[model samples]
Each structure stands twice: as structure tokens, then as C-alpha cells.
Target: MNYEKGAKEILENIGGKENIAGMTHCATRLRFNLRDTSKADTAAIEAVDGVVNVINKAGQYQILIGTNVPKLYNQMENLVGPKEAGSKDSANNSGSSQGIIGTIFSAISSIFAPLLPALAGSGILRGLLLLFVQLGWLSETNGTYQILSAASMTVFYFLPVLLAITSARRFGADMFLSALIGAALLHPDYIALMGDIGNGATTSFLGIPAVLMNYNSTVVPIILSILIFSYLYKWLDRVIPETLKLVVLPLISIAVMVPVTIIVIGPLGVYGGEIIASAVNWLIARSSILAGIVVGGGWSVLVSLGIHWAVNPIMINNIATSGIDYIVPFTFACNFATIGTALGVFFKAQDRDIKNFSMTGIVTIALSAIIEPTVFGLLVKNKKLFLSQIIGGAVGGAYLGLTNVYTNAFVFGSVTTFPAFVGDTSANFINAMIGLLISLIVGAMIAYFVTKKEERLVKN
Candidate 1:
């Protein structure tokens, strides 16, 4: 296919990969963080034979080339080298014009992207534990079950600590100080305090009314706290003498910030999260079916533009407040459609390189649930496959809506949410399972037949 030539040409048309500072792919596009958007020849790139579409969003230039994008991505990566050519620029531009909302989303996505593999691994382990327990292979009281469940639960149960460290690093705050903040939030004392408050007891920290809220399995509070910590840490470093700064700054920051977080920041963050969560819940309750279709069909598009992070807090809040969320279940169905369609391409591809690329993309999508490789590498170019995924996602989404499935966990997509179904015995769980299975089967079947017909036509 002369992938190198194609990649080089594409890069050149977009003013060379050097003009690109950072790049990520989502279901149907190569989202490029460019040095300057004006340098990109969007029209020229779109004129390329396999290119599908072009979009500019969230300060990124996106080139859509359909499902076989991962192959081209690899070739582009090879041409451009491993590290992004312009990360410094990306970091600089990150804090500039996008506003506070943009900065927050960018920070969260960048911080979490590296840790997603571990997160998924832990989720899969948790799902397996549930499966074992459900099948009677392990009892909840058994030591083996206890150990395995701990392996999975530890990550989610102590998630604040993890986020504290990652968010600290992302915002350039003191890691230890951030960890201390998270630890305080998860402390037994704090939990007890929250319980007391819930039971109609008043609590105060140094005469200030203490607002007790559980931070476990929560997302927004920790991130927000760390962002505040970052600015505080920076200020402390500036005022304190350099030699004493290292030792004393962290100590002072922790002492001040931890109390502030507990007594003030955490409560405000939780309250804000509640408001956003309530709005989303109102929307879902009012029109779950429409929400399902819109979220399911367009989530990849949202992710492509980095707008998906806005929904993260809402999903976590739904789990925290309502015990389940419909958006996440539909998200799973959407990813399943992408993976299934990719699997079809892997099986049906005649070109050796294309076949190998599709196979690898299937594995990546399964483990990481990153759909860009599949969307750009295979489906977007293959009209039948693209239609198949859309149809499958819409069908699954409507089914989820009709059944009113709710997911307790936060991971997005089908395979990861499988365990969420185990905790529920209602028709919602069954409907979710059916939605996933139907999306996989229908998307794959349609892709197979369609791809075969297309291949035959090309040969003729």
C-alpha cells in the first residue's frame, strides 16, 4: 500500500508531522495537536484518496481516514519518531486560551491516559471476581475470594490516593503532599465524621462547620483539590528560601491544604458535583432512550475532540448519588460495536499488512477500549463496516433505553461493564448483556458480508 509514502505525503500536506505537537486517535479520526492550525492544509489532506473527513475542535486538527487509521498512525509514528515533536508547545498552549474548563479537561485526560491500562486491568480483575462468585466457584467468605477481591477492590477503594498522585504530577504539585490530602479524605476518622453527620450529628473543625462527604470512588473532588494545591505549592516555592523551600514548603502546604480540603474545598467540590449530577440525572430520567442513542452513537466523536471528559464527573456522580448511570452502559455498547467491527476487518482483510494491523487494533481496542485505531484503521474507509457499527450501536442503545439499564461502575464500554451486571438481578442487567451481545454479533455479521461483497466487486 506504500504506507510510508502515504503517511509522509499526509504529514507533508498537513505541514509535516513536526508541525504536530501531540496526536491521539479516536474511533474515526487522527486528532492532531498542531503547532499552528493555519499551517494545516485540511483541504489538501481531505483530497487524499483514503481520507474521510476533517474537523477542528478543542484546539486540535482532526484528520478522519476511516477504520484503517491505526496502520497509518503507526506509519506516521514511525516517520515522526516516538516522542511527540511538540509537547512543550502543547503544554504551553494548554493553559492559554481554552479557558478554565478546557484546561481542567486537558489536565485530567493527560494525567489519566498513562494509567488507563492499569485501571482497565484492575477492572477486568474485579469483573472476574464477580463472575467467579456468581458461578459459585468462590464464596465471599473464602480466603481465596478475599485475596482476589482485594486485588481488584484496592484500586477502586483507594482510588483517591492514586488520583492524588497523578493529578499532582499533572499539575506539578508536590506528590507526597497530594497523597496526604487524598489520605485525609479517605481516613477512618473522616469516614466516621461523615457517618455522624449523616446520622444528624453536627461536627466542626476549629469552630468551622465541617461538611463530611465520602471521597471514595469519587473523581472531581480530588482533581480540584490538587489543582488548588498546585497553585499553592507554586506560591510557597516562590516565597520560601530555596534551601528551606524543599523541606518546609511541602510541610506547610500539607498542613494548610489538607485542612482546607477537609473543611472547605472537599465539601464545595462535592456540592458542585451534586448539582451537575442532578442535572444529568434529570435529563436521563426524563429521556433515557434519547440520551442512550446520542451518547452511544456520538461518544467516539466526543472523545475524538477531547470533549468526553466533561461527562466523566457526571458518570462518577451518577454512581455516587444514584447507584447507576445509563450513559456508561450505552458507552460500552458503542465500544463493543467498534471492537466487533474491527474484528470483522481482521478476519476478512486480504492484504497481509492490513490484516496484521487490524488484528493488533482488535487487541488494543479490547484491552484499552481506544476505538480510534479501529475507526480510522478499518471502519471509516469501509462504508459497510461503518454502517454496521452505527446500526448496531443504535439498536443496542434503543434496547438499553427500553430496558433502563444502569451501571454502578465508572469504566466505559462493554467488556469492562460485564461485572456491573453481576450486582443486579433485574431486567436492566439482562438487557445490558443482550445489548452488548447483539451489538457485537450484528456489527460483526454485517461487516463480514459487506466487506466480502466489496472485495468481490473490486476484483470484478
Candidate 2:
């Protein structure tokens, strides 16, 4: 692939690897945190043969390179060294290091990435169980059904444990310790205690009463707890003697942080999460149409720069507290737009390789809910196609908002989310289907008109 030369040219065009503060790659894009956004040569980089698109958002520079992105990412990382981009940015330099909106989206992508495979596997199993029950093959109360349901439900029910482990790794903390902390939150004793307190129960440490909260399938609390643990672990390691450091530090951390987490951090995090959830719900309750438009239209932009992780917690929190979330319907629109746009590119493209890639990407994204492959492969190469998807997404989101569609489960954007609709036989399901259809139609229509055949563009 002449990746060395390509990597050098790419970094040079983007003002060199030195300009990058941190960098990471999703399935199809190289996301860079650059020190000087102005130094980025977007047009020049786009001219590179393998380059698909370049975008700047949330202080990160995103390079779309499609499914073969990992190879390019390896080259870029080799040149730059792996590190968090923009870590050196002074608070003033970045202008508020991912504002409230940025943080929300960042949280969603970060939380979901490592756990997506497990989520997909479990969701598929759940879907199969639902199918069996619907077909009279097994009763919901049957032992076989119960076992199968448990296999699928366990992932979600004990999600905090999984999040804790991944979040700890992301933040560079002790994995086992993080799981222990997550376990503490889900302890039966704690749940029993909270239940006994009912709506009025609160536990106190010293003189401060711990805010009563549950942590199952919760997001913010675990991530936040891991962040604290990361810092604490680092500090403890520095102070403790080298010979005994590993053993002593872990012991102390578990002894102190676990209690502190249970009594202080965990409760506080849960309370804060609830507040945010409440605010979002209030806004949705008041004007779902506006929320839908903003979320659906802007969701791709969020995903592109790895900011979508922040919102997953909010949606999960909504599901835990409110039994449903309208936000997920908007995400469905976003995925459909990507799929439709990719399909459009597949049909319009004259290059055999490009056409094949686009077709494969579209099918994979639609089936697996992984849009990066399509986004970077097809839409990024065709700016008009990208815009088409966004426009289509906005339209679908608006439609869904008007219908007040909601999803009760935390499934990714694909067929897996169908079960979420099954239990809720409201207009929400119909609205979701309509939203998906609208996104597909609008995106395909736009792409059909905007995309140029490879032969036509190259000839011209």
C-alpha cells in the first residue's frame, strides 16, 4: 500500500505527527487530536489516493479510510506513537474541552465500543429467545426458556461489571479492582438495604448520608468511578515503596476506594446521572421533535469524532429509570441513512473495487449496526452522499419525534433492536419503522442524484 510514504505524506499534510496530541481509530477512521486545527491541510489530504474524507469536530481531526482503516491506523500510529490526542491542550486552548453536549456524545461511543460485541451477541440470543416464545416452541416460564433468557439478559443485567472493566482499561486502571467496585454496587445487601429504605432510605458515612441509588446497567457512575480509580492508583503507586508497591497499593485501593466508592462516589455519580436523565426526559417530554432533530441529524457527527459514548449513559439511565427512551429512535434513523447512502454509492460506482466495498459495507452496517465501515468507505468519499445521509437522518428523526416513538431496551441500531419494539406494542414501534423507511428513501434518493460514476469523474 506504500503505507510508509502515505503515512509520511498524510502527517506532513496535517502539519506533521508532532502536531497531533493524541490519535485513535475506530473500524474505519483515524481520529486525531491535533494541537493546531488551523495547520490541518484538509483538501491536500483528501487528494491522497486512499483517503476518503477529512473532518474536524470536537477538537479532533477525523480521516475516513474505510474497512482497511486499521492498516492505515497502524502506519499513522507508528509514525506518531500512540497517545491521547489533545492531552496537552490548555483548557483555554480547546475552548472548554468538550462541552456538555460534547461530553454526552463522547461518553456513549467510549462506553459502547469495547462492549459492543458482547452486546450484539447477547441481543441476538435475546432475539432468538423472543422468536421461540412467539412461535410456541417454548413458554416464557419453561426451564429452557429461562436458561436461554438468562444467557442474553445477564450481559445487560450485569452491564456495570463489564463497563467497569472496559472503562478501567480505557482510563488505565486495575481491571479486577474495577470489576470489584462494580460488584459492590450490585451487591444484594446493598440492594436489600436500598429496598428497605424504599423511597426514603439513605445510608450515611461519617455524617454524610449516601444517596440511595442502583447501579445495574448504569453508565456514568462506573466510568466516573474508574476515572477516580485511575488517578488514585497512579498516585498510590508513586507513593508506595517499589518492592511492595503492587501488592500494597492494590490492597489499600480496594480497602479505601471501594468503601469510598460505595459510600460517596457511587451514590454521587448515580445522583448526578439521574439529574441529567431527568433534564433530558423533561426536555423530551416538553418538545420531543426538537430533541429528535438535533440528536438524529447530529448523531453521525458525534460518532465520527468518538464523542457518542457520553450519551449512552444518558439513554441507559433513561431506560433504567423511565422504562423507555426516545433518543434511540433517532439513532435508528442515523444508521438507516448510512446504509441507504452506502447502497446508493454501491449502485452508482463504476470502479469494481469501490462498488464491491460499498456493497459489503452497506450490508455489514445494516446487519451489525456498525456504521463506521459504511461512513468511511462510501459517504466520506462522496461529500454529497454524506450530506445526503445527514439530511435523510434529520427528516426521519423529525418524523419519529412527531410520533413520539421510544425504545425500551439498550440494543444497537440493527435488527437486534426489534425485540425492544416487541414488548412495547405502542405507536412507538410503528413510528420507528416509519423513521427507518424514511431515512432509507431520503438517503438513497439524495445519493442517486449526487454521486458521480467513477469513470465520469476520472474522465472529466
Candidate 3:
């Protein structure tokens, strides 16, 4: 990908490292908050070999780079510096000016992007373990299976501790204290206490009636707890004297925050998260086909606008709490449909420019399931290709819904992650493969015909 060359071009066009206040990336774009946006040369950036397209949004100069963004971001960071509060233009980098959606996506990316690589590894491992067990190569009860499952599940089961650290960093809270709060939530005695309460036994913390909610594998609760911690940490630092700040603050903060979290913040967050999960499940239940069609067909629009990740925590929650999720199949369809559209365009486009663009996009999507280059670079520029995407996505999505396909884990885009779709039986894996094949085949055919017809009309 010409890592060093691309990094140099980006820095030069975006007004050098000093112009960058801070930077972050989502699934497909490098979002940079620059001290001065007018200084960037958008034309030069678009001309960069590996660059896709650029946009000014979210209080940042966004450069779309598909799935290879992390590598580019690392190279850029080495060239410039780490993106954080310590940067040169940090004073003007706050998101107050970035509307609601921008702020939301920024926060979502900060927390989830850091965790995706780990989550993908664990999900793939879990899926592999299931595949081996189902094939009778290993018994479900085998010590090996138990150990592997523990390793796989621990990422989720103890996710709060992970989120605490990430959330603490995102919210500018104390990472160690946030982790301490997470540990307290998962402590063995605490689980026992929750079990007792579940069995009709009573419990209290500091004479306050404590809620008996399990925080393991949960998302929102720790976020809320850490939010409260951040505020408390700041407040304590202000009021507490210097001599006793370290010793007295940590002791007092834990004592007060832990009980308040268990009694109030944790339950509230749980309920809110549950409501969101329940609502999505309800929509799927109301009409799986309808939900599938919208999510599958229109998800690209969401991705284009960079808001698709708002659903990340929901997907994770559904799998963690419900044992399976229907949402991913729709996402899977969207990804494959994109690849199909790109392939079809590559085959049909007569112009060398369009042909080369589509071919490159196809290879990228095939390997990493990244659609930005194909999308912004080609699909959006070609109406016929996008039409093919809609048709293909709808077909794949409906197939998933009608056949009851689901996944217990989430992997990023790519057909290679198909193993994660294994269900209690082989039917799920089989159904998903067939549906994906049909979606791609149908989309490509449509795109090919559309291009042929357009060419004939032009000739006539």
C-alpha cells in the first residue's frame, strides 16, 4: 500500500503534523481534527495512490481509506505523533462544535475501534471451537474445549473491565480506578451475593438496598459507572488537600462510588441497554423480512454517513445475552452485496478508469471486506452498480430472515468469517453460504445487464 509514501502525502496535503490537532479512525476513514481546515488541498489528497476520497465532517478532515486504515493511521502517527490531548492544537479540538451525530460517532469509535481486533480474534476462536466440537473431533465437555471456551468467553464475560479502561481513557477518567470499579463488579463475593438475592435472599451495601444485577459481559453499566467516577475523581482532586490527595482520595472515592453505582447507576444503564436490545429484537420479530431488507439494503447509506457503528454495542449485547443474533446476517449481506457490485462493475465497465477502479476495489473487499474504495470511489459514481447493491442486499437479507440464520459472534466484514455463523445444527452454516452465493450472483448479473443495456443505447 506504499505506507510511507501515503503517510507523507496525507501529512503534506493536510497542512503537516502541526496543523493536526488530534486524529482517530472508524472502520473506513482517518478522521483528523486540524487546526486549520482551509490549508488542506483536497485534490492532492484524492490523487494520492492509496487514498479514496476526503470529506470535511465531525470537526475533522476525514480521509477515507477502507479497512487498511489502521496501518495508514499507524504510519501517520509515527510520522506525526499520537492523537490525544497532548497534541499541538488540542485547545480547539473539543467536540462541542461537532453536532450530535458527529459527537456520538466520535465517542463510539473511540471505545469500540480499540476493542474490535481483540473481539474478532475471540469470536473467531469461539467459532472454531464450536466447529471442532460439532464435527466430533473434540467433545464439548473435554478439558481442551473448556479451556478454549473460557479463553474465548472471558473477553465478553469480563468485558466490563476492558470497557472500564477504554471508557476511562475516552471519558478522561482514571484508568486504574475505573478498572477497580469493574473488578469490584465482577468480584466472586459479589457474584455470590447476586446469586443469593436471585434466590430470595436479601442484601444491602452501606444500609442502602443494593440492586442485584450481573455486570459480566455487559456494556452500558460500566460506562455509566465510569462516567460517575470521572466526575467524582475530578471533584475529589479539587476539594482534597495535597498531602492526603493520593491516599485519602482513592480510599474515599472507592467507598462512595462503588455503593452508588451498585444501588443506582448500574441498574439504570442495564435497563437502558436491555430496552435497546429488546427493541431491535422486537423489530426483527415483528417482520424479519422487513427489518432485514432495510438493514441489509440501506446499511451502506449508514456506513457512507459513518453512523453504522452506533449498532456495535447492540450486536455484542444481543450475542452475549441472547446466545444468538439475527442482526449480523443483514450486515453480512450488505458486505457481500458490496463485493458483488464491485465485481460486476469490473466485468462490465468499458472505460479503463472505471474498470481499473472496480478491479482494485474487488480485491480489497475480497481480502478485508472494506467497501469505501469501491463505494465512494466507484459505486456512488455509478448509479447502476448501486442499484445492483440494493437488489443483492434485499435478496440476501430476506434469505437470512426466512431461513432463521444467526450468529453467536461478530466478525468484521469478509466472507472468510463464515464459520462464525454456525448454529446448534449445520443448517445455519449451509443456509448462510447459499444465501450469500445467491446475493452475489444475482447482484453481478443485474449489474452486468444494466451496463450492457446502457452501452447499447449509447451506441444507437
How close is every model to the real structure, measured as TM-score? 0.76, 0.79, 0.89
Q: For all the candidates, what are their Cα RMSDs to the real structure?
A: 5.7, 4.5, 3.7
Clashes of 2: 18
Instruction: Sum up the clashes in candidate 3.
Output: 0
Please identify model 2 stretches exceeding 4 Å from their true place: 1-23, 34-51, 67-111, 198-200, 204-209, 304-306, 320-323, 341-361, 372-387, 415-417, 426-428, 446-460
What C-alpha lDDT does candidate 2 achieve relative to the native structure?
0.72
Which model scores highest in TM-score? 3
lDDT per residue (tens digit) for residues 127-226 in model 1? 6676787778989899999998778667666767888887776677777888988988888877887564552344787888766677886667888898
Clashes of each: 17, 18, 0
Q: lDDT rank, highest first? A: 3, 2, 1
lDDT of all predictions, in order shown?
A: 0.69, 0.72, 0.79
Full-model lDDT, candidate 3: 0.79
Candidate 3: residue 171 Cα off by (Å): 1.3
